[model samples]
Target: MRGNTLSYGTRYLGRIQGIALLVGGAMLVGGCARLRPTADGELLGDDAVVAHARLLQMADTRAMDTLLVRQALAASTPSVRAAAALAIGQVSGRTLNHLARSLLADGDSAVAANAAYSLGLLRDTASVPALTGALGGRQSVAVEAAWALGQIGAPSRAAIEDALSKAALPEPVLASLLLATAKLRPVPVAQLIPFLRHSNAEIRWSAAYPVSRTLAPAGVRAMLDAARDESAPVRALAARALGRSATGDSLAAEALGALDTLARDSSAHVRINAVRSLASYGSAATTAVVALTADRDANVRIATAQILGTVLPPQRSVWISAWNADTAFMYRRSLLVSAVRAGAMLPALSPASADGWASHADWRYRAAAAEAGGSARSSSALLENALPHVGDADGRVRLAAYTAFATYADSSRFAWRNQILVPALNDPDFYVRATVLQALGSRASAAETPGILASYQRALADSLNDARIAAVRYLAAAWKRDSTNFPDSVRAMVQALKPSDDPLVRAEALESSIFSSWIAAPPGRRRLDWYQRKVRSVLLPALAGRPLSATIQTERGAMTVELFSIDAPLTVDNFASLARAGYYRNVQFHRVVPNFVAQDGDPRGDGNGGPGYAIRDELNRRRYGRGAVGMALSGPDTGGSQYFITHSPQPHLDGGYTVFGRILDGFEVLDALVQGDRILQVRIR
Candidate 1:
C-alpha cells in the first residue's frame, strides 16, 4: 500500500466529492450507461466492458482477452482506456506484451499509468523505455512508472536512476526505487544517500534497510542522523536498523543508547519493535529485552518472552528448570524453540514420559507436555515416549505428537515409527492422518512395503487434501505400488483438488503431475524438449503479458506469482515449457526425504527424472530457499526439468542448484507429500 497505490484510485471518475450526488441519485439507472465519447472519437461498447473487467482476474484464457483489451485502450472514456491498459498487462504472451507496451505509448495520461502498471508485470526490458518516458511525463503517470520500474526489477535500472535524478517524483516512489535497486547487487549506493533527509518516514525507513545491508558509509551516517529525529518511531526505526548493521560494536553501542531512551516512549507499538530489534544486539541488548518481559501489555510480554528466548537463550539446566517451574504453556514453548536454536538443550529434552503432564489437572498443560515431548523427535527415546499420544484424548495434541514423530523419524535406526505410525493413517483429524501417511512413508526406507501399502490404501479413501496428498506422496516413493490403481487414485485427487485456497496442494499435484507426465511420455523422448513445451504452452505464457491477480493453477490449488523471468529467463522458460508439454502428468514425485525436498520430473521413476538434457546452473545469491522452484542437477550445470521444492531455506544449495521459480501458493501440499502421493495430471492455466 505504499508508493503510487493511492494515486491509482482517487483519480478519473471516483472521488468523495461525487459521493453525495451518487447518494442522491441512488435510484438512477445509469448503471448500464452508454459509452460517452470524450475529446476522442472512439466509442466503447459491451466487448470493451468485458475486456476491461478482465483486469480484475489474472487467469488461463487471459491471452484471449488481450486483443479485445488493446482495442478497449482506444475507447473514448479515460476509465475504459485505463482498464484496458490494466487488462492488457495482466496476461503473459508475446502478442499481449506487444499490446501492453503500446499502451505505455497511449495518448491519455491514465492510459499511460495503466501501461506502466502492466509493464511491471511484463518484466520485459523493452518496456523500460516507454515506462521511463511515462515517468518524465505529466502528473501521476510518473509515480506509476516508478512503481513499474521497481516491479520489472533489474531491467529498469537505468530508468530508475534517471527518475531518481528528477526532483519531481514523489518521496515514496523514490524510496521504492532505492529498495528495489538494493536487491539488484550493483545498486546506486551513492545516489540513495540523499533520501535520508526526506520528510517522508517511509522513504527514510526504506533507505535505512539497504544502507545497513550494503554497509554504505553515507547510509551509516544517515541512520545516525535519523536516530536523533524528533519523531520517536523514526528514532526507534533508525536505532533498530543500526543494531543489525555491519557497523559492529560501534553501531551497537549507539543503537543501545537510543533504544534505552525510546523504551520509555509512550508508544506500545514502538516498544514492541524495540523488543524484536534486540535480536540484532547480542549481550548488550539482552537486559533491555528481558526488562520488557514484565511490561503491562500482554502482547508486549508475549513478544518479550519470544525475544528473550532468541536474544539471551536459556542454558540446558536452566531450560529444564524453567519448564519445571513455569506454568504458562506458551512461554515454555517459546523457551524450547529458543533453547533449540541456541544449540545446548537437547540432553534435557531426552527421556520424555507418557503421563508426564497429567501431574496438572489442566488439559492445556497436558497437551503442552505432549507437544513439547514431540519436539524431541530427533531423539528416539523421546519420540518413543511421545508415540502413544498419537491416539491421545485431545485431537490437536495427538496430531502434534504425530508430526513430531514424522518430522524426526529415521527409518534406518528403528522400526518404532513403523509399529506405531502406520496404523494412524485413518486418524480422524485431517492433520493426524496426513502425518501418519508420511511417517509410514519414512519407514519405507527400512523396506517395509507391506506397511507402506496398507497406509496408502487407508489414506487414499480419505477426502482431506492432506490424506489425498499423502497417498500421492507414498505412491511416488513406491513406484511398484503406483503402477496399479494408484495412478487413477492420484488423478482423481487432481480433478478434485481445490486449487484456489492452498499452494502446497497445487505444488504436490503439479509435481505429481510432472511424475505422471514422465510416466506417460513415449520412451526415449522424455527429456528437455518435453519440459520446454510445457513451459512455453502452459507456464511462461501464463505470466507473459500482465501481472495476474490469480494467474497460475496447479493440481493442488491456484496462486498468483510475481514472475522473475526478467532475472531468470531460462529457468522460467523451462517451467513454462514443461507445463505446456504435460511434462508433469502422471510422473512420480521421485524424491520425498523428510525436511529435504518433495521432488519430481524423473522419467526413470527414480531420482533420475530429467528432460534428457541439462541446463547450466544459474545460481545467484537466492539459491534453494524454502518454497523455491529450483532446477535439480546431476553435476555443476547438469540441471534440466528435474527440480525440487525445499521445505526450508537451504543456503547450502545457493551455489549449486539453479533457482528459476518460486511457489506463490500451495506450500502445504509440498509439506503433505507424505512419502506416497502420486500426481494424477498437471495443467497450467
Candidate 2:
C-alpha cells in the first residue's frame, strides 16, 4: 500500500520572526525607524550585543546563560534589548512568559515585535490580551503580534472578534487579523464574509482562507462570485477555496462553470489554482483538463498532468502528448514522474524510447525512466533498462532503479531481492541503503529469507545509524515471513543494541529483544541495561546544548535559520555537519508544493537522496507555522538531507514530525523558489 501511493518526494509533516530586517536596518516597512546598537558606556549595552551573538551561536542553552539574557533584556539599546528578548524566549522556553509579555508594550517597536514573535514560538496563550494591544502599534510590531495571536488560536478568538467589530482598522492590521482569524477553529464566518468583497486583494484572500475552510453554502456562493472578481489574486483564492471544499455536492454546477472559465484566465496563478481545483471533480471535468493540458502556462500543464494521472484513465494519451509537448524541463519531468506515481503510462512513448530517455544526459530523465520501469504497463520493453542503473553515477537515478526493481520485477524470472537489491543494501548512500532494506522487506518471499538475512547482516555493520535501523526492520519482516533457526538474526540485533551511538537503533533493537520470541539466549532485562546505558551516554549530551545558526545560500538569495539545537540536537548536528561538508552545495530543490512547502538538499536532484546516515527524530511542542524549517521524514526517523520551509501554517503536522529550525531572515525567498532552484551552499555559522 505504501509503494502503491508513489509520492514523488517525502512530505514530512510535523509538522517566524521578521528578525533580520528590523534588527539589521534592512528596510522592511516604509518610514519605520531603524534599530541601532547602544553606546559603549550604556549598562550591559556592548556586553548584551556580544552575549546575544553568543546566545545565537549556542546549540543549547546553559542555566548560567539565562542570567546574562535577562541582563541583556535590560540593556539601553533597543536592538540589544530586542535580541535579548528573543534569546530569553529561545533559552527559557515558557518560563519567562511574564517578562516577554511585559516587553510586548516596550517603547521600542523592534523590541515589541521580537517579544510578540517569541511568544508565538512559546505558545503563550494567556498573553493574547497584551498581543492584541500590540497589534495597534507600528506596522512591523503589529504584523508580528497578529502572527502571535494566530499561534495562540482559540484563546485569542474573543479578543480578535472584539477588535474587528470595533472602529474601522488599518488595512495592514485588518489584513493580518483576517489571516490570523483564518488559522483559528470555529472561525467567525459572519464577520469574515463582509471582507469577501473587501477592496484590497489581501483582505479578500484572508477572508477566503477561513471561508474555504468552512465550506458553508454561503461561503461557496461568496467564493463563486469572487472567482469572477476583477483581481487575479481574488480569483486564485476562490479556486483554492473551491478546491478545499471539493465535496461532490459542494462543487455546484455554477461553481464548476466559474472555475472552468478561470482555468483559462490570463493569470498563470489563477489557471494553476483553477486546474488544481478541477482535479477534485474527477471525470466530470474531463473536458476542462483536456483543454488546460495544452495551456500556455507550464505550471497549469503540470497540474493538469497530475490530475490526469489519478482522475481519468482515458486521458493517458493526453497526458503523454502534454509531456512530449512541454518545453519547460521541470514541467516535463513532473509529468512523467507523476504519471508513474499514479500508475499511469505515457501511451505515446515506446519501451525503446523510454530506455533511450533513461540514458539521456539529464538526471531527471533517468530518474523518470527508473520510476517508469516499475510500471508493468510502461516497462513491457524497458523492463531491463533500469536493471543496470542500480549502480548509476547519480544516487537519485540509482534509487529510482532500485524502487523499480523491487516494485515491478518479475519474481519468477529475476532474483532482484538477492542479486540487485540485496547487494545494494551495502550502498554508500544511506538513503539508498535504507530504501533497499524497505524494498527487501516488502518484496522478498519466504524462499528468499536466507539472502535477506545476509543483507540484514551487512546492514547492521553499516556506518550510518539509518542503515542499522533498516536492518532491524528488514530482519523483523523476514522473520515474520519465514521462520528460520538462524540464531544470527538475534545476535545481530543484540550487537546493534549494545555500544551503539544512535538512540533510534538502540530503541528498535531493544523493542525486538524484549517483545520478540526470536531471540533465544541473553535475558531481555540484561539487554535493556546495555541499551539504556548507550542512550544515557550518547543521546542525552547531544540534547543539552544550545541552538546553532546556519546561513543557507540559494541561487535567489541567502536566508539565516536558527536550528533547534536543544530540542533536536542530533538532527541539527547531522544537517550542520553535512552543510559543512558541502553536502547541499549546488543541489536542486527537486519538489515544490505551492502554498505548502519547498523541499531541497538532495545532491541527486531527486527527493530520495540523502547523506550517508539518518538521525532519530526529536519531536516537540513546536508548531509548524509559516517559515518553520523541519526535516523531511519518509516515516518515523527517515529524515536526512531533505528539509522544507512551510509557506503557511500546518496544524495537521503537530506531534507528527520533527521541528528543527526557524527561518530568521529572507522568508520572501521561499515564496519564489520553484523546482530545480539551486542551493549554492549552506554555511553552519
CA lDDT scores, all candidates in order? 0.51, 0.63
Tally clashing residue pairs in candidate 1. 62
Q: Give a tens-digit lDDT track for model 2, residues 323-368.
A: 6766676666566655665656663234556445666787777777
As a TM-score, model 2 comes out at: 0.66
**Tens digits of per-residue lDDT for model 1 on 1-685?**
0000111112111000000000000010113335533234444443333433332222222333444454555545465566556554444444666677776666787777666666665666777787777765655566566666766767778778877787866664565566556545555767776776778866765565455456655565666676666665456555445656545655666666766655555655456556666666766777787667556643445455555655665466645654454435455555554555454453334445443453335544544445555544256445544565666776656765666666653553345554667667657655576667666654333244444445545644443344555655664555444444345554444334333222223334456442444333221112323433433333233333431121333345443444444234445655656766877766666454333455666543434234533343333323355577666643343445666666544433443455666777776566545322455655443
lDDT of 1: 0.51
Candidate 1 regions exceeding 4 Å error are 1-64, 75-80, 212-221, 243-245, 311-388, 406-424, 435-464, 470-685
Candidate 1: deviation at residue 411, Å?
Answer: 9.8
Scanning candidate 1 in windows of ten residues, the lowest lDDT window is 14-23
